[model samples]
Target: MAHEKVNRTKFLFKIIFIIIIIITILSFSTEILFIPTSNNITTPITVLPPSFNSSEEKFLTYLPHSGFHNQHDAFINAIMLSYLTNRTLIMPPILTNYYPPWSTFHSLYNALNKSVIAKKYRKEHCYIKNDGNGENIDNFCDNNKYSKYDNFTMLNWDQLFDLSELKKHVKMVDRGYDFSLDNLISDFNVGENDTYLFIEDKRFEFEFFDNDNSTRQIHEDFEKKFLISDLIKIDKKLLHFASLFHINRIVLENQHNIEFRHLIHNTLIINNSKLLNIANGIIKKLGDKGNYIGLHIRIGDGIYIDEAEDNKILIFNELMNYLLESGLLRNSKKFFKYNLKECVSHNLPIIYLATDANDPRKNLYKFYKNIPCVFTLMDFSKDLENFGNIPSDFDEDTNLKSFYVPIVDLLVTAYGNFFIGTPKSTFSMAAVEINNLYHGKNALVALP
Candidate 1:
């Protein structure tokens, strides 16, 4: 009888364990469970968290396009639109690209670092095959390693942002990846007739001012500014924006709205602790908070690339003038008196260079050679050994550590006491925002 009781207990325990697994699977009806394959590899699946509310409220959404910062801009605009209209927000997966520096950059890097023996010093080129049909093949690197990464990855919203913290100010939700009115309407979120799409010149961007009393003509390029208050009068169930990419897409002129925007920006901090911890470790390696000087230089593409030499000089000089004015240097004449070697000998402030120039040693080294103790993300690879923990967008098989370098640059360089970045580049703009946030300052932090 005693032996039979023990057997029964074991059998019950097994049944309970199986039931718990089933319940857990059912609850995560909207998340991805990584199932490992025979090779100990998992497929790269974009997890779009579903938060379909039963509440009969209107919704607002926009197509997320371009790189991370561009998508970030559109998201901010979408949430503001949702708030102003008092509607729920339907978010699409944030689109990311694995386009590394052009092939020439890699070619130059390999040539420049040929003497360097450390594996950590080597940069990863985009190994994912892409459709470069009918375009200048010279524009991209062809070192395909991961057949799955096609230059783009649809990342979940929470992967880049704290959706819960952001949703506190706005009612945001995601309905898989589709933004089609038909699909959303099918979900019973709204009717076709009840929806309103801001149909404008699809090729050009138009600004939508939030306040009725403000006359802020931000951009004149595709010239069209509409008031957000007018949309509220439509009384529709869903307000769809075809495109909202520009930083000033939704200009907040009202003082109250401006204040609220600041609050929202503060709350919309980078959500990943793993990334922050990695950043903190990098910061510690860089001598910690307020100890170093940060500089972000964007050489840009196309016409900007032609003007790279001139633009980089302008940015570098601006940084110099800034340092001189701030008394960081001994004297205006002695600025850059120490070469990198001498700077290290003298123990001058470390200069962290956050750039998109591909091969900085070849293309940009001459420009900043006079700086004391100049370093890039590659210089601190030992500290960034856990960058693998940094979530990437594409195939899990492909170690797209290169994809997060710019992001890591932003995080690490933001801690510098003196920070300056390229004007008008969204990447630079992000660096400034981050610098300010880390120091408990406003979003538009003062820069040189």
Candidate 2:
């Protein structure tokens, strides 16, 4: 009877153990079971406020040139627009962040935010292979590495939509307008409160401002509006009044032994510190023997590499001769004396920030090492960040996001603030303006 009891007890324990295993499997299955089927999938669309198309709501614009610059601009624009509108701007989940700079700049939806079902269709539809023709080419086309859609990876737009962050409240969208005043009307986020334009073109004229109906009221009745421009000819006085906040400024001052007003022809801002270090180092290396003068070369999109580089070198030589013969550097002798002592140790450096830093013409640097010149490399893979216990995903690019280069930050200063930069980048423009505003008539920061 005791042996029989032992067998029964062991059997009962096995039954319980099996039950527990069954329950654990069911729990995981339930998590995967909730994924919705295609028949029931619905695209997430924002419900706009009644004022969205009304003439009374404002249109805030956040424009960018493209690439990582566009990505950064989108985040910044969303933050500023949210602050202005005082409401959340809803976005559609049909856009991809990855595209050509121009294509991404003008995308109409945020594709990454779509539900898994929508993503299935997008992966099928947004392919160059699926260009609407049913020609399903499934062969292993080994020679097609550089084909239009061969290596295109999707952008992670979903990672950006945290409601807690101010910079992501605004949605990524395309402005439907080029010449039509209606394009301005459609871009307004009526219910959320503000409208923003991240501009790429200078197409709007005073005539483009239309006050038609309730649709036109937003542009007409803005409590605050801003027009941020990197264009060289933007009028500073007009922009300040036009913006709830305008980020550009101008200052007039003279310091050292030179009347800086005479030499203050034009300036651009530089915001990236690594870039600045590269530039500063190159200048120090090249122009260590004399006063250094800097020039930026931007070749046309279609130009040959050989021609552009040759032209740039010739131009540099001519400019140097002019500075000496015209007494430009000599008449303002003390200014250059200060520059020489501060910026170089051996030769006068000539820095070139080419769109394609690899232009074979940059080989000029090899020949002119004694005349030292530098180029800025935007890559920061070598720069390590503080990594204690952060998760791998967050730590992947930590050094880049957390690293602040003061040179880039200073670009937000006022115009003519003394420090200057090249015009090709808005980062530089902002630095110039901020420096001028902060210093407020002081000499440019002199490094030891």
- Backbone clashes for every candidate come to 0, 54
Candidate 1 lDDT over 1-448, as tens digits, reads 9999999999999999999999998878534432211211121111232344434456777665446776777677777677666567788666554312212322422322221111111124432344543342443332233322233444567776776655645656675534344666777457558877666654355677776777556566557777777877877777776666776667766655565567566677776766777778878767777778888877857556777777788877887787678665543235466454555455576788887777877777764565546688877777678866434443343344555666788877777887887767777777778778778898764311
Q: Which stretches of candidate 2 lie over 4 Å from their true place?
A: 1-65, 70-77, 89-98, 101-296, 300-357, 360-448
Alpha-carbon lDDT of model 1? 0.62
- lDDT by residue for model 2 over 256-359, one digit each (tens)? 11222111211212333444453344333334212334333434433434465665566456655755674543322332333333434433333323233444
Q: Would you list the C-alpha lDDT of every candidate in the order shown?
A: 0.62, 0.32
